[model samples]
Target chain A: MKNKLLVATRKGLIVFQRDAVSKWKVIGAHFNGIPVSMVYEDPRDGNWWVSLDHGHWGIKLHKSNDKGKTWEEVEAPKYPEGTLVKEGVDATLRYIWAFAAPSSDGSNSLLIGTEPGGLFRLNIQTSESKLNQSLWNHPSRTDQWFGGGRDYPGIHSIVLDPRNDQHMYVGISVAGVFETQDGGNSWMPKNKGLKAEFLPNPDAEIGHDPHILLASSKQPDYMWQQNHCGIYRTENGGDQWIDVSDRDGEAYFGFALAMDDEYPERAWVAPAQSDEIRVPIDQKLCICRTEDGGKNWNTLNSGLPQSYAYDIIYRHCLINQQDELFFGTTTGNLFYSSDGGDHWEALHQFLPMVYCLTWAD
Target chain B: MPKVSFTKALKRFYPTLENKIYIKGDNISEILDGIEEKHPGIKDYIVEENGQLRKHVNIFCGEDPIDDRITLSDMVGEEDEVFIIQALSGG
Candidate 1:
């Protein structure tokens, strides 16, 4: 028997297979160009969707039906009636940063997040020529950006309820979070406690832009947000949020956050560009875990070095299987923990920036 | 005046765009020129440097393909709908 670990990386996509003995081997490379975002395998089937944009390949939609064996491309996706799409000045690259698949809601759907925070949806899995509709296309969003630029709120993260796919939310680079209750029909702002530190006021009702987001059916309201200012969570489903880290006594800005596959509330996260350089700036890497929900958190830096370690991690660069939580540091360190957050092991010393970590069993 | 509509996916960057009039052209060239009269630079995105349809760009008549030989004049009509899709290409 064998299992696979699928990853979308800067070097392209690679599938790592685990044999009967659990020895990992590089099974395949699906694309050569830069695959900025991708899905390993959908629970529905081996159907995979990858978004890549590297050097004139522009932005692309790649599909694999046979467990990363072969691939197909959908040049254009079908849209609903009256859904008029504007053209881009720069046709060189249309970046698709994130994608969300169907959840346990029994509603089979897909959400693609692109640069400039353009949101589109595939309501049903009919055919390549029939993917339809815009989940949330704010008419005045482009003009309402906080910093007032194109790079604002590109929608890098689309978080779906593992239990109910219809109930979902997305985090924008600068605009913040938007939630949708009816699958992909419409959306509304769910940023109550969010605080965009970059704004003129840090305690404002609006503008706590989110860069990355993670959601689990078990913790529906407890989605994690890796923001430009700091790490936050919405315990009431984007209504109110709280800071997961208290850096007053410890370093806390974060970009990477991972939750347990089996238990959504249990999570592990790391610090990165978020640190304002005043949070102790400890190079000794640390992984913080929260078991009883985000009520409390503790650092699991036992097997880790005693000092001098700082390698920021990306939002999707971490994963957890049961109690085995793993995180990849920009320092090229892949750390693994078995006792939740108490003990740890450095799986391999070097592996690029270690952009992502995933497992199959 | 009969007009052609662009999809929301296309309207993203070009927000000012909605439904455009078909400049009195019988052939694909004339129709594009007509569109250019109303909106400039859009024909450039639809056509190519050599005037060939860009590989990723496709124009459809109902559900049929529209190309140089079978220009808009042959396929497009007041009764028929035209859809121009710029392939949303990605990984």
Candidate 2:
């Protein structure tokens, strides 16, 4: 099991370690008092990368070669000059929403998803970054894709097929899902079965909001997403998506999702009350788990707040490494589960508003 | 030459950042370039990729705020004091 946890919070990047007694405690904190948008560990080289959102200074990227001991600021991805989100809006790096390292062994490249719906490929060795023109120049982006929560559409999820480095999928708010089978040279919209209730045509080819997207590492073809309207699953590499939301239960709307790597039939979601009310379901905090591919959902709330709770989990806040699961909330609460979603224990309740959570060796 | 000063908050990143220094430039844009040469990567915090002042960043030429945020065409007098500050914002 991973023994260290990295919590990217609104105030800083915090590190927690499991002690000899198996208790998690704060081990270190970096970028104090600065909003950390994302903390990513490059799986290929174990390098720590952090994205900072300086309200006045613009966005920045930093990397640590020696764990969290030292850090050096690197070039944050930049949208090319004259690139426009629309007719006159010059595109810029508003936010670094997602980071993915190439699955191919010893590759010195990283993929970044940003606001204004630009995907960047960064060469780590030379620190040179370029926007993926194919995705940026997609036909529907300029006219059809608009902002959801942010002022501009953002790419927040990048899932690379572990079996094939060339195949990948990106999740964009208000723009739906796009798949690239040839290393991002081109992309095709994969929202065949998604519903955009806000649009005049709910079954339009694009403009579906997928809050978070995940794929089972063991079964790469099986994918799942916690969408704005409901929950969905794809069994055949996103050829078609099946709506599996619990209509009568408290599992219809949420932003965070986690999938079992070895079991394609199992998944988990932290459901909010609804899209309009961004809080725990019924004022109770619980994690809904599905053992039979979303056919049924079990509410797991043991050791969690039972009533009057108002914690909301962000898309990247819920993560799992085998049976050990961890999630941090926007309310600054962090919880850990040793045995899947059967139970949870509050690790810390007073950190900064947690943005994302990840584990390190 | 105009003397350029920065917000103390920047010292966290550029520990060796001097509170103030004289830079040779005729306009805000050229002055920023001179600052970047002295302290690498500091200019990005003040401006964006399009060379426009960040939304929440402000620059003052003596007691007057810079006029052209996009082109930064505001000229800096040789004896003027250029102050770069982070606008008070966010919770």
Candidate 3:
């Protein structure tokens, strides 16, 4: 029996399976300098999708039909330069930060969140069709999204309604959530209650830096995010958001959130470095859980150190493996949750800022 | 001479570089040059294009980060060691 785990490494996609205890068997590795953002294996199809840095390998996908035996690379949809953007600005898609599994309304597709903020779709064509992308580019919106990390929208996390795939939501760093009820043809900002930590007291800017944003396949509407200043949740399709920060005696706001696959309401998050002033809030470098959605929160620091970790965590980097929740902190510490986010233990000592973690068979 | 060593990250790429040899050099320059002549890419990765030690790359003469990043001309007598490591990032 091979226990496998998919790591979305800075290098390409690496499939790490244990031949036995304490031994790792990685296959079809990609590490020649291509930074991979997220890698997820579908339970139904037993396939792999690896998202790479935009400028390097945009919306790249890799699949393995054979039950974890050998893997194949997906031929991504390539758009010739000068087709979309005008001449100038040496732009190379440099980052793809997040990925989400598609739902029933589509071709069991894959959602890719890219740098400079944009959404992309991957094709799950058929048995004969090799792993490749059919749709490469989708604008963030029709009227140009208000404010992203920069001039354009850069996506960090994408979520789909478990029941209907057409209903989708995505989070753009330094901005807000965008929803598309019509299967991504057009989009609009879904953020109504969300707040931008970096936003000036006035309204000079319209966006905030997103540390981490997660939308579980199970509970698409129940989303979580750790932003530049606080942690928040929105149950009504980003129409209304709640500030779950500990600053006001409410549950401590976190930057890293891990939503369960089957249990959407139950999610995990961790206290991250916030603002230049205060000591790291709820900053145990520990992952906490909210059992009844984001209404309440608790700290799960058993077997975990109480010392304040220095690095800020990106929300999508947190994940759940079985009942266990896992996250990579800024200090290069990888924590795993066995009984949800209640108890965590260090798994890997250090790796280059673990951008994302995903489970496999 | 005091024995210096590379961290686990360094050992991964160069497994042969274990606690095998120890020598004293008059200066850090001579010591690193001697190492590069043996391990080609190691020095380049540790030292930057401007000939400065990369932030992630570190060295110690027993709890000291080699006094200076540039002036490696300090003499290392019969009891100095150099330790290198991967850049540490995150909280």
Candidate 4:
């Protein structure tokens, strides 16, 4: 089990360390009073990277080589000059949504997903970044893609196949999923079975909002996504997707999703009421788990708030390490579960509005 | 030469930032370049990659706000006091 947990919050990045007795406590806090959009631990080299959303200043990126003690700011990825979100609107870096290390074995490259739907590849050693032109120039982006909740479409999820780093998939708000085979030189839409009720054409080739996408590390071909309209799963490398949302329960709409690495048939989702009402179902907080590939969902609410709770989990908040799970909410509540989703315990309830959670060494 | 000052909020990131410094430039753009030379990477906080002033940043040339936000073409006098202030916003 990881001893340290990094909580990226609206106000700062909080580091929690597990003591000798297995009790987690606040170890340190960095970037206080600043919104940390994302905190990523590079698996390759243990470098801590944080993306900051300075409300007054522009977006900034920083990396820490000595855990959370000291940090060095790196040049944030910038959209190329003359790049347009549309015909007249110039593309700017609104937010840094996601970061992924392409290789876990001493690779110096990192992939970043940003708002305005630009994907950047950065060299950590050189502090140089280049925008992936293939995805940016996708023709459907101009006509079919638009924002879901934000003002502009954003790339929130980047999943690289464990077997092949070059084969990757990115999830974009209001733009469905796109897959690349030859290291991002080209991409193709992978939303064959997704449904977008908000769009005029429900079966359009693009414009599907996948709130979060997760691919199993054990079986990369199996993927799961908590979509805006419903929950979906792909068993054959995204050749087609299957709608597995719980029609009779509250699993149809939500953002956070966690999948079992060894068992693709098992997954978890923190379900909200619906799109219009972004609260827990029936004012009760429960985590729904599926053991048989979304055929049935079990509501796990042993130690969770059952009434009058209004905590919402962001897409990057819910994560799992084997049977242990951790999640942070927008209401500044953090919870931990030692035995999957069957039970949970509040770790902290007074941190900043938690944006993302990741386990580190 | 114009004396350029920054909002104290910036000291959180760039702690060594002086209260004010003299820079040699004839316009806001050139002044920003001179400031960047003195304190590396400080200019990005005020302006964007396209050289447009960030939406929430304001640059004042003496008594008036800079007119040209894109190119920052507002001229600066030798004795001008250039102020880079973060706009009042956010919760």
The TM-score measured for candidate 4 stands at: 0.98
Candidate 2 structure, TM-score to reference? 0.99
lDDT string for model 4 (A203-280, tens) is 998999999999998899999999998999999989999999997887889999999999988999999999999999
- Each candidate structure's TM-score, on Cα atoms with residue i matched to residue i, is 0.69, 0.99, 0.64, 0.98
- DockQ, all models: 0.04, 0.88, 0.02, 0.81
lDDT of 2 by residue, B26-67 (tens): 999999999999988898898889889999999999989999
For residues A156-220, write the lDDT of model 1, one tens digit per residue.
77777766777778777667788888875777777777667676777654466675787766666
Best by the DockQ measure? 2
Q: Give the Cα lDDT of each candidate.
A: 0.60, 0.92, 0.58, 0.92
Q: Candidate 2: what lDDT?
A: 0.92
- The candidate 1 chain A region of ten consecutive residues with least summed lDDT is A84-93
Fraction of true interface contacts that also occur in model 2:
0.83
Candidate 2 regions with alpha-carbon error over 4 angstroms? none
By lDDT, the better pick of 2 and 3 is 2
* Fraction of true A-B contacts recovered by candidate 4: 0.70
Worst 10 residues of 4 chain B by lDDT: B42-51
lDDT winner between 3 and 4, please give it.
4
